[model samples]
Target: MVTDIIAQAFVDFIRRVCECENLWKAHAKDLELAKVGDEVTKAISEGVEGEYGPVTVKVRKKLLGRREVRVWLYGNEIDVDALLAEISKARSRAAWLLNDCSENALLETLYKYEDRYLIEVAQRNLDKVKNICAGELPRIEFGEAPAHVVEGVVKGVRIYLSGHGTSA
Candidate 1:
């Protein structure tokens, strides 16, 4: 029936969002490794009118703390616009799916997603509070990087869903 089809579509949308989050998290981890020692160089030559130069920059391998770990390559200048666009598309799809469902079903789905959002937010908040209370920030080892990015994706999707237009 139409209801079954709509339910399936919603399930598929959720699956796709999870897959994208995983993909982005993996990509972020790779980028963290790659960005170490990334270099930009500037060449400057004296010109008659003024200084004319090409700017180049270089990055060195730096230890990143827990706070720095949150600053991943995923939201960096390189692909953030594309990432946001993709999230917007997902939100639009979720909204359209909600429209297709009956009011009761839509409300159920919204409640479910909202619960998931709240659980994730609480977990993150607890982690931050624990860190602060412990007086030790989480350390970012190579293995810990992807989870941070995945958490970021969860927060982003939650924000998108809870924001102005999508609210129940």
Candidate 2:
């Protein structure tokens, strides 16, 4: 709790410096925000690691054309990053189902595979998935799935929303 507060304060400090730079753009030296972020991470990391075992703090560069950059504090107890990746894949599948499958077909598919759903996630995430079914389908910005995109089955289809709509 104390560490969280301190971390937030450090984040606020960097944000203020950026705000000042924005106000005096040409006058100000461009702050190496990455270095500042690294220092903040180092400052707070030791206590956190002592409290929780084998913690890693990562400060990432914001992606090009992206608005938000995040700091991640990970504990080595379990492979949380791998777990997050799996859940992210599962959540993407759920969103794909919610968007691509028709209402009747989706309910029937869910009914048929209720056991699969239960095995996949807890109630809170299941509720998040149920809420996903309520929204309008997202217009996919990409014309084709990327080369790195994994192929997987959803509701007996070989891949989610195949172009020809045939099992492969």
Candidate 3:
């Protein structure tokens, strides 16, 4: 129960940093925000593993004036350098899309880019949640029950019967 509270606090910290207002505005078109929300839900469902968790993202590209520009988003563990690299790769692919295909052909590329970006943001938020949880848990005494155990046994009775004594 205490760990749950700590986890929730961590989520709240992520929410504060991610900002609902910005998140809403960022995905207002075509239920993009809704999709991002779903991804976040999926990430949380995966639970915290070590310092972070993993999530999936989709990215796409849009073409304008003979040039295909890519947009990307993602959700998962935030590694800023890795994200930048993914973005760079997406942009390069977008260039190829522009050179070899029509505007309509860029649809998949645009979606892929956007998804990548969403995943990246989600990861950053997850990290924040982890940090918050780490900070809050030390102050509480939840008893020692092996750090690996997320839930402790409560309100349970153990009975042992012996020749000389009976215990419960």
Candidate 4:
């Protein structure tokens, strides 16, 4: 049962990162269009196909072909960098939990297969996993998986909208 939870949690982390990647890709495309003074609002909305749940976008057309785009996830304003950082941290914690639980022979033997929602199952079982381990878990350094563009112009429309360099 515990191993099942661990696997589910690992999968959830992976899926969440995938969703973030989708969002980043949308940002890139929209920003590129905005840079060229093209209509970006429609492009932005069309990019998000509701796969990651409710994502809201607010775009303002500024003078001289500048645009300001802001995004929200589940009604909370989000900074792409900050959102990625938080999700990465959560995934790391989940990874540690999964690792520690998988090391237990008894727990490994008791794991059962299920087709239920994996993330919900993992979240529900996480506390139980910690109790089962009942000891300090060694820090597991994933060493930064190749992530979304971490900085510079690719982040969002900020650079493109600010008229910082040669226009596209």
Q: What Cα-based lDDT does every candidate model obtain? A: 0.34, 0.31, 0.33, 0.38
Decide which is better by lDDT, 1 or 4: 4
Candidate 1, lDDT over the whole model: 0.34
Give one clash count per candidate, in the order shown: 9, 0, 30, 2
The Cα error of candidate 1 at residue 140, in Å, is: 33
Predicted structure 4, TM vs. truth = 0.27
Best by lDDT: 4
lDDT of 3 by residue, 59-119 (tens): 2233662322222243444443454454455445444434433323322232333333323
lDDT of 4 by residue, 30-64 (tens): 33322322222343534422213344556677899
Candidate 4: lDDT over CA atoms? 0.38
TM-scores vs. true structure, each candidate: 0.23, 0.18, 0.19, 0.27
> What lDDT does candidate 1 reach at residue 74?
32
Q: On residues 1-168, what C-alpha lDDT tens digit does candidate 1 reach at each position?
A: 433333343333333333444444545533333333122111111111111111122223356621111111232433323433444454454444434432343234335434344333333343332232223333312223234444543443334344423431
Report the lDDT tens digits of candidate 2 across residue range 32-146.
2222333434434322222212233333335793332223333333343443343345445444443544334333333333333322221223333332223312222222422
Q: Which ten-residue region of model 2 has the weakest summed lDDT?
A: 147-156
- Candidate 3 segments whose C-alpha is farther than 4 A from its true place: 1-73, 103-168
Give me the displacement of residue 15 in model 2, in angstroms. Answer: 55
